[model samples]
Target: MIVENKEFHSRICVDALENAKSVFSPLSSEEKQLLLEQMIAHEFKKGEVIYRVGEKPDGVLYLVHGKAKIAKAGIGGREQIVRMAGVHSFIGYRALFAEEESYASATTLEETFLVQLPFETVVSVIRSNSDFALALLKSFATDLRFAENRTVTLTQKHIRGRLAESLLLLHKEYGVGDDEQTLQVLLSREDVAKFSNMTPSNAIRTLSAFAQEGVIALEGRAIKILNIDELERISRLG
Candidate 1:
């Protein structure tokens, strides 16, 4: 269930922290309590902006539920999706540790629940805990690597390859429905284009092409992969 109040938020936070079994696992009970005390839960509807470019980092925002996309506005107000954050993910943190304004904006892809860890408390915990600091550093490095790879993909991959890769990425992030074919997440064509670095018209045309070729089956906002092998091949070739 979605966390609605501070008490429930605290419980969910504890559960997420425990399940992380990384940084939070090593935290002492007192430390955990301290973090829980500092945390504040906020809910957002689909398409709501959580944070925007040039906004100063207030705290570390954790995705307690639902999904969000991190993107940066490019020429002509076109948005280039940097990454998609799923449940149990952290968003808008790169700017927090860097001590700078956010370079990207985070927006909810669906109704989302967020837990904000006050920046002061985060700094204090990291100062007191070397393990947590190290974990966060590792996470930052991993994100940098992903950004580097995405740069290569978006710049070099063909349109078909880019769209194929995006579908695969969405599948990995959100999984599939009960039928094990249709994707779990529902996204507008515009959002899909932003993720794939294409215009909405192009995205629509290519998706139609894929559908005609039987590479995928499209039903409104739903996309079902009918030929995973071919999709992977297209991604590989590009």
Candidate 2:
């Protein structure tokens, strides 16, 4: 859930800016301040749609806190998750740069906070700053590489491999909780299936199999890694 404290919101927004050092570092102090002034903070509840396919990109959305799932629907209304993004990243920017409608949808995986910078302001700043433009280009390249890798994984991997890789990916993204074993982000079976590109029933069965094999433990929505080596081996085997 989003904290209601305005002070906390402002603090995290600053933190998010700090975390994005590569992007903001290129700007002059005055330019940074000007861009910060134009930012507007927004909070979204779990499962809320941040943006949808066919929507015109109005601004670049910076995720300040919590997680979001980016996905595209396929035939028969199935969802194929493109990726999950957390704090200290920008969303909806590719569409904004392309001057086209969003090609995919972004939804809040949990209560999330974001700061939106106007598209016009972003364009203006990029036009004025070569460093910032180069940084954005690098970000786009990174995402494109990730998309290419995911395409290979989904097409070549078996169900066991796919789910194992997904688990490893989630751990890489959200990390572990204070227990250092339980996953920080709690995803429902359906969400996991969508992210893994499998049917919900198959996802559930595979998760149960993992538990039975002593690779993981499930307690409600929490998943604890019991055998990291084994899980990684399964992921790599595919």
Candidate 3:
């Protein structure tokens, strides 16, 4: 996916440090305003590519609305989702720091709103603002921590466990449905496979098996949990 630097003009800008509070601690108003000046809001349509693998790294992109996935192509051009990103999170810095091209890709899972900060501009601000720099560091640490957990789940878990963990993650990131049992996100089977670290066919088969076991109830793209507690137990066991 490509991230184009489109100009935006707004009467006011967000308090960048407050927006970064998810990773950075609180900041002073002066610092927030200073950092905000370096940001530009960008809108992305659903299914649009944000950045492609091997593309030059440009900057730190933040999610203001909607969601996205950090992914990489696996064997045969299949994709594997490494992370799910939403409001207040940062994306597209893996290559920027190394001064190399991106190793993975990022794309909007839905119509998304983002704040794109040029890498050099942000680093310049960070150089002067201790809070901003620390926040950026914390963001990096958060990504790393999630990566470590994902490595364990994808590498060690059984198929059921992997699926369960993926669903749980979806529930956390996307939320439950009106029925309070169904996952809210409408992910394609391929996306599910990518997120679950399984082949598309395997994800389909296991989900079907779960249906047979009365672990879940499916309605086209909507999946309602029939026995979430048991699913959790199975995931834990795996």
Candidate 4:
């Protein structure tokens, strides 16, 4: 379930809107204040669906805290994770910009906080601010580049290489824990398989192989990179 947080004036929400990469950053103070007044803040529990495939976007979504995954369901009800979003990231904007229903679903990986900017308000700002429009275009271009790279990784890489790359990606996005080895984010085995574009059994086998090779250490959902160089080599060779 999702809870609507009435305290939209919280510092995190304000920072999310005013941050350098924010779409609303180019607006004047008065404009931003007005926009904030119309925004809604939502808190979602771990595993809760933020939005589902085919749903119409009500607004622009900006993550203020926690992690989430954007994925699409495939044949036989299999899921393929397209991307993982962290704090300060934007999700669902692609469909909103295209004026179409969402092609993928977004779900929280942990307890998450988000600020939603009303669609009409965002549209009005884009029309009045050329800089904001350009920013949006740049964001679109960056997302396209990532999509292109991921397409190659999923199709061309071997199972081992795919899992290695997925682990590396998680390390990059969430970084390490206090030990400087274990990843901070913990994802279920199914999520790992979906993100790596492989079946759960395949993913599990590959992970065990890596563990035996001393490339990584796994403790339940916690993954520790014991040999970053070897992991990178696998990804590069694939």
Give per-residue CA lDDT, model 1, range 1-238, as digits (tens): 3356767677767765777633467677888889888777787899899999999988888777789999999988878988988887788887887899999999898998877888889889889999888887777787788889989999999999999999998988888988988998898999999999998999999999999999999999999998889999989988
Model 2 alpha-carbon drift over 4 Å, by segment: 1-9, 20-22
lDDT of each residue in 1-238, candidate 3, tens digit only: 2234433323213632455345534556665565577767777898988899999976777777788988998788877899988777878887888889999998898887777677776676678778667767887897899899999989999998999888888887778867899886778888889899988999999999999999988889778788889888988988
Question: What is the alpha-carbon lDDT for the whole of candidate 1?
Answer: 0.86
Task: Please identify model 4 stretches exceeding 4 Å from their true place.
Answer: 1-9, 20-24
> Which 10-residue window in model 2 sums to the lowest lDDT?
15-24
Instruction: Return the TM-score for each candidate structure.
Output: 0.91, 0.92, 0.85, 0.91
List where candidate 3 sits over 4 angstroms from the true fold.
1-21
Give me the displacement of residue 42 in model 3, in angstroms: 1.0
Tens-digit lDDT track for model 2 on 78-181?
Answer: 88888988766778888888889999999998988888888889789889999888987787787789889989998899999999999998998899988889
Residue 211 of model 1, lDDT score:
95
Model 4 lDDT per residue over 42-101, tens place: 888999999999999988898888999999989998889999988777899989989999
Which lDDT value does model 4 have at 105? 99
What TM-score, to 2 decimals, does candidate 4 have?
A: 0.91
**Candidate 4 global lDDT:** 0.87
Error at 103, model 4, angstroms:
1.1
